[model samples]
Target: MQQADIIEGIKGKYFQKFGETSNPDKVRTFRSPGRINLIGEHTDYNNGFVLPASVDKAVYFVIEPREDDQVILHAADLDETYTFNVNDLSKPDQAWSHYQLGIIEQIYKKGLKIGGFQTTFGGDVPVGAGLSSSAALECCLLFALNELFDLGLDRFNIVKMSQKAENEYVGVQCGIMDQFASAFGKEESVIRLDCRSLEYEYFPFPMQDYLLVLCDTSVKHSLASSEYNTRRLECEKGISILKKYYPDIESLRDVTPEIVAEHKDELGDPVNRRCKFITEEIQRVQDACDLLVEGNLVEFGQKMYATHQGLQHEYEVSCPELDFLVDQTINDPAVLGARMMGGGFGGCTINLVKKEAVDDFEQKMKAAYLQAYQIDLPCYKVKITTGTEEIL
Candidate 1:
């Protein structure tokens, strides 16, 4: 779908529900694209590097400011509406409202002057597919508010606010990569983010003959959330043990694979494996960046596969469904490389596939996946897009 069509669709829905009561000129529309991590999984919190791009799928918001303090929000996809006072700022019983409420709370905490507003939002981003839909929602609403109220919050600050919404309000201890990518992404390029220093540089992703496909496992294991925190704890334990020798070591990012190997006995099996995966994964991100700059897609794809192997065997995050999806692509000539992306107990496997063979590969993979697990797998073809912006 073209940009114009998307805007028109949102406008049509807004007018239909709101009954053209508000002045069209006063209404502002905004969009924020979802993000895909091409490489560097589980390395963000460790202060390592990540390569991510904002995709075409995004959340759209149509908002109009009100004079009163009452904030009205309508989620078009869920067919739910929520009303709250800015002064109250209480968490809603419904879960989806938390994303918007959290942002409002953060904006208020920053001392930004904002009046209540009525907003209707919906999007094409597939929920729980490893695409950062929550980040996209947070970013779009924050960006809209910034423009509406003249908040003067820069892109970096907006990214920080979006992340804070998730961390503080939503109670998820997430890294900044998702929100950063959604707020700072560019078309036809991927941002190489240094999670430690918050420094980033964009590299060209000229995929004229290749496609970025996500094969969704369609199953999110209950263990994903708890295990994600467990892995972080294990990583911290390893770092503390290494800190005995190298006091300067803060995270796995600072420790080299050789250093981990030399001190393997003290680290034990679990801690040693976690440290190895993280340290080597950081190195893989650097290597992938270099290959991408040289347009070495073949080698880059191989690095993705290697990262999956480490995530599977060493990090122990990959689940059976994720493993099955990636394993199917191992021997296919049409597939360059594939790996399970995101927190990883269950999610999609990012694939670099030949554009010409995407259809055949999808059909075969879908059939094979369904036959193997008796469950359907959804595939999404995503294109890189720019970050959040107001629609003209």
Candidate 2:
């Protein structure tokens, strides 16, 4: 369904439940979109750069003010409802409600006056497909609260609050890129974010004949949550160990391949490999940005292939299905380059494929891959779209 129809559906459901309009006279709605990383994966937490854009897929929240300091939420996607006193501002019931509770908790912690409200939200962003469904929900709640309560917080501050909610309250050590893109992304432009500086610039993703296709392996990664934390810890451990020799280093971004090579023996094998992937991934990010700027899709595709190889060989994050998906498409004339995107144990493979050949290409991949792995992969045909805001 279209976003407007989705919003109207939620409003209709709320009225059906409450026997009155949630917004007595009128209601204010807020929207926040999910993001797709065009390139530069797994480099965000390492204090590197990432090229991501907000997608048309989004979460929409319709909210109405309340007199009491009690925030009430109802989500159609999960078929769940939650209520919490804004004065208390503690964690909500665990499970699906935490994302919304995390946003409220962070907003209160920011010294803003919390107010009571009723909200209903839903969206079509495929969960666990690496399209950042969580960020869409968090950002929607944050934006709704900001507007409903007249908190006067800017977009960046809202992004930070949402990030904090995810990091501290929701217990995800994710980087800022997801939430940042959800809040500040522009239409038809890829955001080049300096993760360290929290500064960004938008660059046109010079469109070619290729479609940016996301093929899901239908494998929900069991290691995604835990392994993600472990990888971050490993990177931190590498930095801490290397700091003894290179006092100037903060993250793996600081240690070049040359520096790591000099101290290769000292860092041991595991740390060495971890540091190696990070440093090289950082450089690839810079190079990818340069290539895109010069309208060098061919070179960008090559970098993407190299990136997958590094993630598979050096980072050791890609699984068999991911490996197969990428390997099968490496030499396909219609496909520019393919790589496993997201937390990576198993998820989607982002491919740049010739638009005209997409239908045949997808059919061939589906038949061949299903025969090889006995699992059907879902593919998303996406276009670059803007971030979210309220619609009158």
Candidate 3:
């Protein structure tokens, strides 16, 4: 559907729910898009590089300020309503409510004055597909609050605040890439972020004849949460070992391929493998960025395939379903590159495919995936879009 149609639908729903009681002129609308990492998986927390783009899929918030301190929220998709006191700022029992409450808690902690508000939010971003839907939700609400209460938080501050909300309140030790991408993204461009310094450079992404396709594996392993933490600890251990010899080194980002090779014996097999993948993956991001700048889509696609191999063999994050989906495009010329994205174990494989061949590739992959795993794979064709903004 068109962007105009989507906005109108959201506005219509908001008025239907709360327009009668609230003045139409007082209501404000906001939107934040979800992001997709083309490469550089598991590199964000390691203080390495990542390339991500915010897609057309987004969360929309329609809100109005209230005189009382009570904040009312309606999640249109889940058909659930939650009410809480802005002054209390306590976490809720419901899992979905945490995202909303966490943002509010962070804003209050920053000494920003905010009034109570009522909001209705819904989105097209797929849940649990590794599209960073949580970031979209947090950013949309935070952006709305900033505008509603006249909070003077800039985009960078909003990004950090959203990340803090998830880490401190929701108990997820996530990096700033997702929230940063959601808040700073631009249409027809991708941002290359340096996690350590929070520096970024944007490159035009003009893939006129190619498409960004995501194939959901529909299998989220039970170990995803535990394993994600385990990987973080392992990376830390590797960094500590390297730090002894090189005192200035902070993370794997500072360790090069030569450095890891020289101390391979001291790092051992497991630690060596993890450090090697991170160091190499960081280089891949740079190479991919160069390819993007040169407009060499073919080479850029090859780097994506290489990233998947590293995630599978070196990082030990890819599962069988994710591997099978990527393997399906091995020899196909129509497919440029494919890799399992997000926290791994199970999620979606982002593919770079020829525009004309997308349908054929999707149809065959769906049937093969269902036959092998008896699970249906959902495909999404995404377009890059701008970051959080107030809709007129």
Task: Point to the candidate with the largest lDDT.
Answer: 1
Pairs of residues clashing in candidate 2: none
lDDT per residue (tens digit) for residues 34-67 in model 1:
9999999999989999999999999999999877
CA lDDT of each prediction against the hidden true structure:
0.91, 0.82, 0.91
Compute each candidate's TM-score over C-alphas: 0.98, 0.93, 0.97
lDDT of 2 at 224: 73
Question: Candidate 1, clashing residue pairs?
Answer: none
Score candidate 3 by TM-score against the native.
0.97
Tens-digit per-residue lDDT, 41-81, candidate 3: 89998889999999999999989998888888888888788
- The whole-model C-alpha lDDT of candidate 2 against the native structure comes to 0.82
- Residue 93 in candidate 3, Cα distance off native in Å: 2.4
Model 2 regions more than 4 Å off: 92-94
Report the Cα lDDT for residue 2, model 2.
76
